[model samples]
Target chain A: GIQVEQSPPDLILQEGANSTLRCNFSDSVNNLQWFHQNPWGQLINLFYIPSGTKQNGRLSATTVATERYSLLYISSSQTTDSGVYFCAVGEGNSGGSNYKLTFGKGTLLTVNP
Target chain B: DTAVSQTPKYLVTQMGNDKSIKCEQNLGHDTMYWYKQDSKKFLKIMFSYNNKELIINETVPNRFSPKSPDKAHLNLHINSLELGDSAVYFCASSRLRGEAFFGQGTRLTVV
Candidate 1:
């Protein structure tokens, strides 16, 4: 089983601030995804970067598969961004019976105006 | 339209009772999964189904059974629910190697 650890268990910042969340995995992964669980308990997919880097709006993520770590960047954070961000990864080849995502405990972020 | 939809946004039942949560996905994905989020917000995968076949089953109890009648539908049934079974359950779907899309989640409370 692959172990995923998310750093900065809890974070609080003023609106418009920027923050970086990191996720480290114990083994190589075939799939890695970043998700934001809003207050409504909806797990919104932010990025699906098994490797490399990607950006969407004010949010971006970079994954170094070789190093087995992923970084999520939130720029100009807003009040609505206050929630739990999760990093989940799937180990081994993608299509096997043992393939399933293992989620980290997550990082709780709070942005206040 | 919702890419992944699950029925019964909230469920309240007494101990020893049985309940089921229904899920459907229109994303044409090959994999569907059931994840349980405890009160502490720790999410764990309970089961995974690929193309109507059971692929992965974690160390979850036998009281919880997941059924996939087809590629687009996966349902979870719990028998003799206990207090420990109370949690938010999320249904998700994705391609073999793609990102997963989750449902809003069904909150189950056992009294």
Candidate 2:
């Protein structure tokens, strides 16, 4: 089993602000993803960065696999972005029986208008 | 159209009741998964099916079973549900990729 830890378990930000969330894993990962769980309970895939950086709209993600850490950044945040953000890491072994992903506890983000 | 969709947006039942949640995907994916988000908002993998075959079975309780009648569908059945079974259930689909498309969750409440 792999251990994933997210920082700043709870975050509060004013609308239009920018923020960065970090996820650190205990081991190397073959897959890394950032997800946003909206108020309606839909898990929206934010990024699929096992390594390198990716950007989409107001968000971006960077995964430094060699350092066992990843980051998600939200710019020009909106109130609708308030919810739980999750970072998950799949066990590095793609050929093993444990291809399951281990998720971090999540960072609860609150956007204030 | 939803890439991944689930039926019964909300479920409420008695402690001893039995229920099921249905999921479907149109992304032509070969793998599907069921995940449970407990009260603490912790998402854990319950079961996974690949091409209608059981591929990953976590340490889920025996009362929970997953059935995949075809590549596009995977349903979860719970028997004699307990109060602790109350949570949000999410359905996700993916192939040999890192990202997964998730359906709107089904909130289950046991009284």
Candidate 3:
């Protein structure tokens, strides 16, 4: 089994603040994804960065597969961004039955207007 | 249109009862998954099906059963529900080696 840990379990920011969320895995994985679980419990995909960096709107993510870690960046945060962000990864070399992504506890972010 | 959808946005039932949740995907994806979110918001994979074939089944209990009719629908049925079964369940779908899209989630309350 792979161990996934997320840093800064909680965060608070202003409307124009910037923050970075991190996820570290105990094993190597080829499938890594970032999702934002909105207040309504809607888990929306933010990135699929198994490696490298990607940006969408004010959000961006970077994953270093070899280092077994990934980062999610939120720039100019907004009130709507107040929720929990989750990082999930699937171990690539764990033999069979390792196709599912193991999720971290998550990072709760609160943005005030 | 929604990529993934689940039925019974909320479920409240007594212990020892049985319930079923329905899921469907309209993204033309071949793989679908079921994830359980506990009270503390920890997400864990329950079951996964690819192209109508069962694939990933975590260490979940046997009381939970997943049924996939073709490639577009995957349903979850729980027998003799217990208090530990109370959680928010999410249905997701994706293509092989692609990003997954999750549904709105079904909140189950086993009283």
Candidate 4:
């Protein structure tokens, strides 16, 4: 099983601030995704970058598969962005179970207005 | 329309009771999964079904059973629920190797 670790277990910032959250895995992965668990407990897909970089509105993510690391960046954060950010990954060598995603503990972000 | 939806957004039951959570995906994905989020907010995979076939079953307890009637639906049943069973359960769907979409989550409280 692959292990995923998220950095800075907790983060707090004022609105309009920018922050970078990191995720490091112990093995190669074929699937990598970033998700935001809003205050209401809705898991919103942020990015599905197995490799390369992708940006969605004020959120962006980059995954370096070879290095087994990924970074999620939030620009000009708003109060609505406050919640838990999770990084989940699926091992490339899981055979028929490659679709199984192992999640990290997550980074708790709080953006104060 | 919701890509993935689950019934009973919240559930509360006494110990020794049996309850089931239903999940359906309109995205037509082949892979569906059940994940549990504990009180501390740690998320872990419990079971996964691909194309209506069970593929991944983590070290979950026997009390937790997951059934997939088709590629678009997966349901979870818990027998004799205990205090430890109280947590948020999430249903998700995705392509064989694509990004996953999660439901709003069912928060279960076992009294």
Q: Against the true structure, whose lDDT is highest?
A: 1
Predicted candidate 2 versus true structure: per-residue lDDT over B1-111, tens digit per residue: 889999899999999999999999999988888999999999999988877888788889999999999999999999999999999999988874447788999999999
- Would you list the clashing residue pairs of candidate 4? none
Model 3 gets an lDDT of: 0.91
* Best-performing candidate as measured by DockQ: 1
Q: Write the per-residue lDDT of candidate 3 for residues B2-104, one digit (tens) a residue.
A: 7899999999999999999999999999889999999999999899888898988887899999999889999999999999999999999888656888999
Could you give the fnat of all candidates in order? 0.82, 0.61, 0.74, 0.79
Model 1: DockQ vs. true structure: 0.82
Summarize candidate 4's per-residue lDDT along A1-113 as a digit string, tens digits.
78899998999999999999999999988889999999999999999999999999999999999999999999999999999999999764446564688999999999999
Of the two candidates 3 and 4, the one with more favorable lDDT, higher being better, is 4
Error of 2 at A86 (Å): 0.5
DockQ for all models, in order?
Answer: 0.82, 0.63, 0.68, 0.77
Task: Sort every candidate by DockQ, greatest first.
Answer: 1, 4, 3, 2
Candidates sorted on TM-score, descending: 1, 4, 2, 3
Tens-place lDDT digits, model 1, residues B1-111: 999999999999999999999999999999999999999999999999989989788889999999999999999999999999999999999887578899999999999
lDDT of 4: 0.93
Chain B TM, every candidate: 0.99, 0.97, 0.98, 0.98
User: Could you tell which candidate, 2 or 3, scores higher by DockQ?
Assistant: 3
Off by over 4 Å in 1: none
| Better model by TM-score: candidate 2 vs candidate 4 | 4
- If both were scored by DockQ, which would come out higher, candidate 2 or candidate 4? 4
Question: How high is the TM-score of chain B in model 1?
Answer: 0.99
